[model samples]
Target: MTLDDLFSAAREAMAKTHSPYSKFPVGAAILTEDGRVFTGANIEVVSFPEGWCAETTALGHYVMGGGGRITDICVTAERLDECTPCGGCRQRLAEFAPPDARVHLTDQAGITKTITMVDLLPLGFKTEILST
Candidate 1:
C-alpha cells in the first residue's frame, strides 16, 4: 500500500487499542517485501511487563505468517515525537528491515519525519556475534 494508505491503516488500528490503563495508544504499520501491509495496535495489560508494543505485535504476526522481509515502517501515537519505538523495538525491527529502511513518524500536522534504520540505530548489534 502507498504511504498515505499505510498511515490510514495504522490509524485504524490505533482506534482499536484497549488502553484503559494508560490511554497512551500506539499504532504501527509493517510493510513486507511482498507488498503486504500488516497493522497493529498497542495492547496494554494490567501486568505492565506483559504488554506488547504494537510494532512488535505486528512484526511477530508477520514472522509467524511465513517469513518475509520488511520494506518500510511507520509508527504513530497521539504525539509523534513521543511515539518512537523503544531500543528493543529498534533491534527487533532491524532484524527484518534493511539498514536503510525508512522509518516514518507521523506528526500532529500529518507530516512525517523520514529516517533510516541505520540513523535510528547506529552501530546496531545484530546476531553477528552469535552466528560467529
Candidate 2:
C-alpha cells in the first residue's frame, strides 16, 4: 500500500487511543510481508511505565495473530507532529521489521512525513550481531 494509505489507517487508529495522562493519543499500523495490516492505539495507565505504546501494541497483535516479519509501519499523533519513536520503540520495531522498515508520522492537521528505521535509529544493532 502507498504511504497515504498507511497514514490514513494510522490516523484512524489514533482516534482510539486512551492516553489520558499525556493527552497524547497516538496510533500505529504495521504492514506484514504478506500485505496484511495491523493497527493499534496507545493506552495509558496511571503509572507511566505500565502504559503501552502504539507501535508495541500493534506489533504484539501481529505476533499474537501469528503474523511476524513486518515490512512497514506508520505512526500518527496529534501531539507528536514529526516526532519519531523513542530509542526503545526503534529497537522494538527493528526486532520484527526488516532493516528497510519504513515509519510514517503525521500530525492532527494531516501533515505527514515518511522515514525509514535507519533514519530513526542509525547504526541499529541486529540479532545477527549476537550470533557473530
Candidate 3:
C-alpha cells in the first residue's frame, strides 16, 4: 500500500480515539514488509498515565498478527501537525523496526516530514544487545 493509504488508515483510526481525559486524539498505522497494514488509536482510561499510545496499540496489533519487518509507520494527531511518537514509543518502535524504516510524520493534509527509524531514535537500546 502507498503512504497515502497508510495515512488514510491512521486518520480513520484517529476518529475512533478514546481520549476522554486528554481529548487529544492520535492515530498510528504500521506497514509491514509483507504488505499488511495495522492501525491503532490512542486509548485513555480513568486512571491517569495508564493509557496506551497509538503506536503502542498499533505494535500490539502487529505482534498479534504474527509480527514481521515493519517497513513504514505513519502518525498523526488531531490537535497538532506532524506529531511525533513519544519517547517511550520511539524505543518501542526501535525494537521492531530497522534503522532504515521510514517514519512519516503527518498532519491533516498529509505527510509533512519523513524520517528514518534511526533518526527518530538515535540512542535507542538495541534488541540484539538485550537478547545477548
Candidate 4:
C-alpha cells in the first residue's frame, strides 16, 4: 500500500484510541513486505505506566496475523503534528522491522517526514544477539 493509504489507516485507528487518561490519542499502521497492512491505536489502562503505545498495538496485530518482514510504518497523533514513535516503541519496532524500514511521521494533513528505523534507534539491541 502507498504511504497515503497507510497514513489514512493510522488516522482511522487514532479515532478509535482508548486514551481516556492521557487524552493523547495516537495511531499506528504497519505494512509488511507481503503487502499486508495492520493498524492499531493507543490504549490506556487505569494503572499508570501500564498503557500500550499505538506501535505496540500494531505490532500485536501484525504478530497475530502471522508476522512478516515489516517494510514500512506510519504513526500519527491526534494533537501532535508529525508525531513520531516513543523510545520504547522505537525499540519494539526495531525488533520486527529492519534498520532500513521506512517510518512515516504524519500530521492531520498527512505524512510530513520520513525516517528509518535506524534513525529512530541507532544503538538498538539486535535480536540476533539474543539468539545465542
Q: Which ranges of candidate 1 are over 4 A from the true structure?
A: 80-82, 109-111
For model 4, residues 44-82, the per-residue Cα lDDT tens digits are 999966999999999999999999999999999989998
Per-model lDDT: 0.81, 0.80, 0.95, 0.94
TM-score of each: 0.90, 0.87, 0.98, 0.97
| Candidate 1 lDDT, 1-132, residue by residue in tens | 788877787788778787778788888888887888888888888997678888888887778877577778888887455368888889988888888788888874443688889998887887668797
Report the lDDT of model 2 for residue 112. Answer: 67
Which candidate number has the best lDDT?
Answer: 3
Tens digit per residue, CA lDDT, model 2, 39-119: 888899999869988888888888888886677788878776876776788988887777777777777655367778877
Displacement of the residue 33 alpha carbon in candidate 3, Å: 1.0
lDDT score for residue 90 of model 2: 90
Off by over 4 Å in 3: none
Cα RMSD to the true fold for all candidates:
1.6, 1.9, 0.7, 0.8
Residue-pair clash count for candidate 4: 0
Clashing pairs in 2: none
How high a TM-score does candidate 4 get? 0.97
Query: Model 4's lDDT to the true fold?
Result: 0.94
Model 2 stretches astray by more than 4 angstroms? 109-111
